[model samples]
Target: MVGRLVIVTGGESGIGAACAQAFGAERARVAVYYHSDKDGADRTADAVVRAGGEAMTVQADVDDEASVDHAFTTVEQRWGVADVLVNSAGLNMSGVTVREMTLAQWQRLLDTDLTGAFLTSRRFLNGRGDRTGDAAILHISSIHAYAVRAGGADYCAAKGGLSNLVETLAIEEAPRGIRVNAIEPGMILTPMNAKAQEDPVYRRTLEQNIPMGRAGHASEVADLAVFLASDQARYITGARIVIDGGLSLMQALGA
Candidate 1:
């Protein structure tokens, strides 16, 4: 992977940060994009350098088209073109039902989780990155796309849309030599889910639902990301690989 360029949105923390580190370990030139976490982004970049790889931090709100464009332009100017894109920026708003969810809240979730992927992928394509068959796009979707929660209507909708988007893009971009795929993760310990992790009862309730009897680590998901972006998955496209550690299968089995 030496000299390959990768751009990871939300790369400052959580699964995104793990993926950045994984790619960097392979000596890929990584662009760590963060929305409001420059410090976290910087720390991730520093870790990449410490891992004997090259990386740079970029600030961009993935929900904003201009910011997305600027970030891709910066990547192009610095690294010429990106070979991989991991769309990992997302948001979740709880306590609002479908009827009670405000317009702003719904829009906010859609803009960040769904539109963000669209904007980033468009910019990456327009940046002339698709000319290489080695280029890949990975979307960090959620198991909520298939599993439902009471107050996660917006989040579920956005992720569900993303899953379909990945399939569509995979088919559309195949002719262009680019592969598109998504990872639908189950409950993972991250800053966004800190409250869930802190609540013992809630945590146990979540773990009980997983056949693996545990939540996944960000690094575990990153491992799949690295594989999917590498030559190992050259023929894999239009696939929504579930990395939920048997949660989906258990759900299917009524466990």
Candidate 2:
């Protein structure tokens, strides 16, 4: 990945931050895109530089078309075209039942998780503008995409839609040498799982459900992301790779 231009959205924290650093360790030029987290973005950028890669911070609201466009445009103006895009900006499950979910709550999650993917991907291809070679686009999706959850209608639906979008993009852009894929994780120890990260007893209860007997770490997911975006995974596209520590495998238990 030396000298490669990489863009990682939601790079301010969690799996996104870990991915930025991982790519940096490979000496990739990383653009850390964040939303309303200047301080966090700066910290990630510093870490990227420390890891032996060029780093830049760009603010963007993934759900908004203009914001996504501007963010990509900024990166392009500074560094010709991005060689990779890691769309990790998203929202967690609302934990509200479908019957109780309001229109606002549903729309908000869809806009961020689903529409965000569409907007960023479209802009990324547009930025390339007929020039393409070995570029990759990775969406940090969730096992919830297929393994449904009772209280996660908003998040689950968005991820489910993302699965189709990834497949569609893979076919649409395969001729351009752009590979699109989804990384579906479960119970990763990120800010999105703050309660589990903070409360050991509570976490243990959940971890017991996982065959691995533990929750996953952001770096673990980041490692997979790097691989999928690398030449090693050149032939891999439209694939949904699961890194869930066997949790999703047990979804049908007791049924």
Give candidates' CA RMSD values in order.
Answer: 1.6, 0.7
User: Which residues of candidate 1, in runs, are more than 4 Å off?
Assistant: 252-255
- Each prediction's Cα lDDT score? 0.89, 0.95
Model 2 over residues 83-189: C-alpha lDDT tens digits?
Answer: 89999999999998999999999999999999999999999998888986899999999999999989999999999999999999999999999999999999999
lDDT of 1: 0.89
The ten-residue window of minimal lDDT in model 1 covers 246-255
lDDT of 1 by residue, 1-255 (tens): 787899999999999999999888988899999989899999999988877679999998999988899888888887788889999999975558989989999999999999999999889888874375668999999888888778999999999999888999999899887999999998788888897778988988888988889899999999999999999899999998899878877756654
Cα lDDT, model 2, residue 28 = 97
Cα deviation of 214 in candidate 1 (Å)? 0.7
